[model samples]
Target: MVLYFLALVFGLHIVMVNLGIAFSTVIPILKRKGEKENNEIYLRTSKQLMNFYAATYGLAGVFGTAFTVFLLSFYPSFIGLAGHLTFIPFGIAILAIVVHFFAITAYWYSWDKWKSDTHFLIGMILLISVYLIPLGFRAISAFLNLPQGLELTPKPHLDVVAALLNPTFLPLYLKSVTAALAAGFFTISSAYMLKYGKGDKEAIKIVEKFMPLATIAFTIAIVLGIIYAETLNLFVNYKFENAFGFLIAAKAKYDFSWLFIIKLAMFALQTIAIVSYLKIRKAWRFSKYIVAAGPASLIAIFAGEMLNSFSQYPYFVAKLADKEFVSSIPQPIRDYLAERLNLELSNPLATSMGLYTLTLVFLVPLLISAVIFLYILLFGKERSEALD
Candidate 1:
């Protein structure tokens, strides 16, 4: 249950953070197109995307903090050890986030106040900064799967350059960025589809414009995902082996392969839905399919992330030695920690029922309410105006 709660927080953080990434990725292009063509819809969408990113930024911070706290409380040893090994990447991500926030603020506030090109440059800065975030964090994630940069024995040490250049890092980063693009465009398409249902003819145009982009991005994500999985297979093949065995739950043991299939299915559905909507040109009859795209993309993203995490069960780091992947943590140390800390060495407060109850009752509701508030602000009849 505790691990599930932690996963929930991490998942929320991933969604919100990716939303920011997706918005940042598209906003500048939209702004530039709007400027070049003098299209009101494009400009309006760029502004609206900025607004959505701003709204989710706070929620992302909240979830990120909650995730960090959960890690600190429950997985102190893991945090302590992992933090030491991956501090460089973490620092890079943190720095990028700070710069990204500032760039977003400047881009949002100086919209018409600055020259068109000047303002677009600010948006570009925002885009670059935002993208750099995933670059650093994904390296850390890849490192966990293949701890290539660090020596585990004779006093642990990390080679920063080697860590950043891990085998799985590039594909994972590309997959995440492309997923962000798909999710962002699909989400925008869904929003416009809703307005189109409410008799806004203009909204359909917006949907038409974004749906194709979403499909393209999703296609790239799918390809990159395959590349990522093959890279992971180089380290861990068990995740791909017997991938569909979960369908026969009665006879099969649990495995993370089901997640991979579900993610692919969702992605396929989203792509087909987008293509069909583009071909049909009837937003009303296909409203369900159009709106479902957003949630489908999100589900696919979540499943992909969880598959990566769950596939490495029972160990935090997998170091390659003599052409085989094995736990980076030595067996003797694991045994000592288990014996001394009762098999919960990674989670010091594993038995803290009171703290768990407090978090579930208080912290969880607060986070949920914040999300509700954001939904109201973003989708309500009275939408928030751009800061400028």
Candidate 2:
């Protein structure tokens, strides 16, 4: 239950956060070019994306914080040790988040105030920071898996440097880059499809330009993911006999190739949807295929996550150590959940509270926001007037 909830919230949050990074970087470039070319499409698209990013940014924060709280609450004991060792990475992440807030706020609000070069420079740093933010996160996650630093157990304490240098850190970070780019570009492309899916040539052109990049990034993401998994298989003690089993015969144990196959198949269809439209421009001028890419990308991402998590079952952080830590949950709660829900529980108490927070805070706002978004979509001018 905990793993599923974490996956649900964490996966959604990761997509939105990376999308914010992607569009934030693109908006300034598009703004500059739009000014030079006197292209209303570029200008309007940037503005719309800015509004979308601003709105979703708040939701991302909510989910991200919720994710952290659940982690701490569920694995209080294990994370206490892990957190002490991993605090440096978390510290770096928090500092980055602070800078990110101010940078993005300035970028978003100072559009009318700042000069072009100055604003673009800020946007560049903002992109750098956005990309840098994930490094700390993935590093910490990697440490949890490999935990080489924990083994160091320095005289004073754990070596922060060694912890950050976990074997899987670089590979996972590289893998995450693919997800960030693919998600980000897909977000931009989908937004274009939504706002101007009504036979707008400029909008279609923008979609054409961005969708291809999204497809390509997703392809690279798959390749990087394979490399990362192979690195993990080599490094981590707990092996997935089922992962890459069909392709890599030596690794085969059972019929666990199904998820891997489906994840690839979904992305393949997505690529075909994007490419087919690119080749046949006239017939697909306003094709649903363009909009269809949104769902396809999301499904692919979710499926990939499911496959990754499923391959490593029954262990929260498995590594070669004197002592191995299993799932982080009370035994009674874990047993109850297993018997009743046929699911594993990480932190039942945290899950209960987190669900409340998710419902009241995130879910309610989502409902209200959905209605408001529909109003904006259906009647932007009128809604803008009423809000004003």
Candidate 3:
């Protein structure tokens, strides 16, 4: 259950972050074009979209902080403490939440009146700063794990700050940013199809203009993702050992033919989505296909990340001490379960959260299907008209 929750949280974070970047970059560019062309509808829609993106950014930060705290609670030793610790990363999380609130306030109240140039600059700075804060915390957390074990002390000859500053960090950051941009572009493309595409030639023209931007953003994201993976391989080889090492060893034993096939399939789907957007100029038929393709690629990326995390599992902190620390069932909990119920310590993962698994398997898909059906029923005409 915890793993599933974590995956969902991380997936949402990736989507929202990318969407925020997409709106931040693409909106301004489009707004400038709208103004030059004296296109009021385009200007209005762009501003509204920008405001929505800014608001969603705050929501994402709030959820992100909650997820971070949940993760910390699950493995407190990751920060060098048995329980909560006043680490620099935690401090940054708090600061990010505060900044996100301010950004949301600025976006909400400035709807009618144009913000002063100074205020707008400040708002932009705050938004960008908040966006990067989580990345910084993640990098720090990963670095602090280099020593491994239950203690917070820095490992011999290993500096957490120095590890945080390694060459790999910059590439990772860029990769994440580009990924966010791709997500944003994909989302905006969907929105354009939903809200504007139809027999409305003007709306189709606007969407057509945006399609190339989305395609370029997605292309950059994929390229950067590949580069980032290479850097990660180097990091694992030069600085680490353990299950991750085991997994790397396993990967090395086999040619990545299957992985390459998956990558190619993802790339082809994304390319098809872009082409559909360029040619269709409508939302009715191919919008869901595009949406699914974008997220499918994202899921593949998540699967790769999961493999890395699994390599580091059981040991919350790695290579920090002479011996690795593994989590144990608390004696009290174990005793209670033993006396009052039949418990299997050897296979906890299978039985730990039966209810959650059931809910995910049955409820989530049903809900999505119902929603999609409702959308089609209500908006089918609009979609058809847009396409016509």
The lDDT leader among the candidates is 1
Q: Alpha-carbon error at 93 in model 2, in Å?
A: 1.4
- List candidate 1 stretches off by more than 4 Å: 152-154, 238-254, 281-286, 318-344, 384-388
Indicate which candidate wins on TM-score.
Answer: 1
RMSD of each: 3.5, 5.8, 8.0
Model 3, 197-310: lDDT tens digits are 344445445456656776887788778766755654555433233323443554332233344455457667778888776666554343555655546556545544444344
263-334 in candidate 2: lDDT tens per residue?
677677677666766675655455566566666666666666566555555444535221333244346544
**Ranking of all candidate structures by their TM-score, best first:** 1, 2, 3
Write one digit per residue (lDDT tens) for candidate 1, span 196-285. Answer: 877767777888888888888888888998898778656544433323345534222336667878987887879777767866676334
Candidate 1: 10-residue stretch with minimal lDDT: 318-327
TM-score of each: 0.88, 0.79, 0.65
Clash pairs for candidate 2: none
What is candidate 2's local distance difference test score? Answer: 0.66
Q: If both were scored by lDDT, which would come out higher, candidate 2 or candidate 3?
A: 2
Worst lDDT run of 10 residues, candidate 3, spans 337-346
